[model samples]
Target: MSETAARAGWVEITCEGELREVVGGPNRHAAHKTRTALHALDRAWLAHSPLCFIATSDGDGSCDVSPKGDPPGFVKVLDDTTLAIPDRPGNKRVDGFTNILRNPRVGLAFLLPGRGDTLRVNGRARIVRQAPFLDGMTVRGHRPALALVVEVEEVFHHCAKAFLRSGTWDPDTWAPQALPSRARIAKALDRPDDTLEFLEEYYGPGYAERLYG
Candidate 1:
């Protein structure tokens, strides 16, 4: 490459002397102050999803990625711009919840297992300990650790490309064996007691009871 082109900040060299393109991606869509996208969680979408990704970040830039899952429809759609969900019992790290306290920004992506498409929601959130929905929710005859109230900003239909490329829904490409054993994963997480055996012993019954009832 010419010295003139190399002098531009768009190119750089790594410690291994590998030349790299620093930044050359087309710009994304402009942010709309008032979103025209769908702002509601449809019952069908929430009813079919088995997992959701939650992203939250503190004011200081400390971020947390959390995975939420259950039978289905744990998230309740209140209206076109609102949703609620009871936070079930767990390890109690509360990283996502705490981040919401100091920062209102929150993002959610819901995926239906074996389905290519997903739902995405961006919004501000707050911890809601007492809500009408929480009134009847009980796990093992105990109330949820907490409930989350999300005020929707924008909701969009996420394409299936990521899932297709990752073979997320393809049973033939599934690698249940490649995953670490439950006990080993818990050990690496510094919670040897967090065995699947233990979680199953506790959550399995509670999840079924609360979900069905």
Candidate 2:
């Protein structure tokens, strides 16, 4: 079948009536949104979550979502309205920091493994590369070189329907997976010398020891 004919059943909801027809009304819990700071429950969730996905947009409207992971409480809750995340050592892509520099607005989704509910925070953020704050986020005696300081504008707990439907926390649903071999990727992109095996050999057994900056 032609592509257009194959997609004929798809309806575009460009008008208000067509949009409302699918969802059928405003959210029932719209009034539950909390603005200005983290509530007690929000604080607890942040304390226990070891990972979160941060979303940011450039001034031109291009966007990126990046994962931040460390030990639980790696994201410090400075106060009801403030929090900080240490920027640990990595390949130095700086996509997230660069985006924050262009546009400070960001959204974070905190996830705890085996826990269905997730915490969401949206706010303004700034990249901080100072001694005192960076030193405070030290892991295994190695301090982070930079930090992302966030001014919490809103915090809320999201229901677990999505996770439940996907069986994210169910062990039986998980299958063994492996990282895509960087060697193949490099060859496909026209560079065969830079490979996964080369990187692993270069990093050596002490690679974990050098993770922190």
Candidate 3:
């Protein structure tokens, strides 16, 4: 490695004491984590959450996070201890699923529009491709080929300090702009072959029909 790169690495925090010195520890309540199969409040929160981000780590310690969103209640409560999230069609990278296969531990954060607080779920997860499970998650006649079965290990509600400071749920705080076309994004990457029309057609209103297995 270059001298600068090697010198940069030497400045990294090597232990908790060094890290805590730079950034102080959390408050007492912040350190207290809630653990439950599923509380009633958690069930209600999950029922209305249409978006969630899940983080997982591979066996070799590599990490990946994937966003999953569908209609409200897309993630079903199988029981107090379990949750079922349909694997919707996407770019098919499957990073989250692949990570779960190697390391079952996952951290999930569910968000509902207009709500400042978020629901957090941490658990062990497994990918299920059984017909029965897949068929149950069918949307518009499109059944998912796979679903994630998450066994709840810890469930809690995260406070809205970050959202409150950022005004995430406030429309007035948002800047007016249209969604960026994939062509524009491709151009930024020096790829000229991706067309705006193709991206528009692929992600337009009718794109909902393609969200099946």
Q: TM-score rank, highest first?
A: 2, 3, 1
Q: Which model scores highest in TM-score?
A: 2
- Write one digit per residue (lDDT tens) for candidate 2, span 1-213: 999999999878899998888888756686666667888888888889999999999999999999999999899988899999988878789998999999999999999999888898999999887846676688888788788999998888888999999999998987644544444555566465676677656556766667774
Q: After superposition, how far is residue 7 of candidate 3 from its true place, in Å?
A: 8.5
Arrange candidates by lDDT, descending.
Answer: 3, 2, 1
Model 1, CA-based lDDT = 0.74
Q: Summarize candidate 1's per-residue lDDT along 1-213 as a digit string, tens digits.
A: 998878777644664435324444334642333353444345579867767889999989899989887657777777777877678766678999889889999999988877787788899898887777876556446666577878888777766888889987788987887987655666667675676777555545465555424
Total residue pair clashes for candidate 1: 0
Span of ten consecutive residues with least summed lDDT in model 1: 30-39
Model 2 RMSD in Å is: 2.9
**CA lDDT, every model vs. true structure:** 0.74, 0.85, 0.86
Clashing residue pairs for model 1: none
Say which prediction, candidate 2 or candidate 3, comes out ahead on lDDT: 3
Q: List the residue pairs that clash in candidate 3.
A: none
TM-score for each model: 0.71, 0.85, 0.84
* lDDT score at residue 139, model 1, on the 0-100 scale: 47
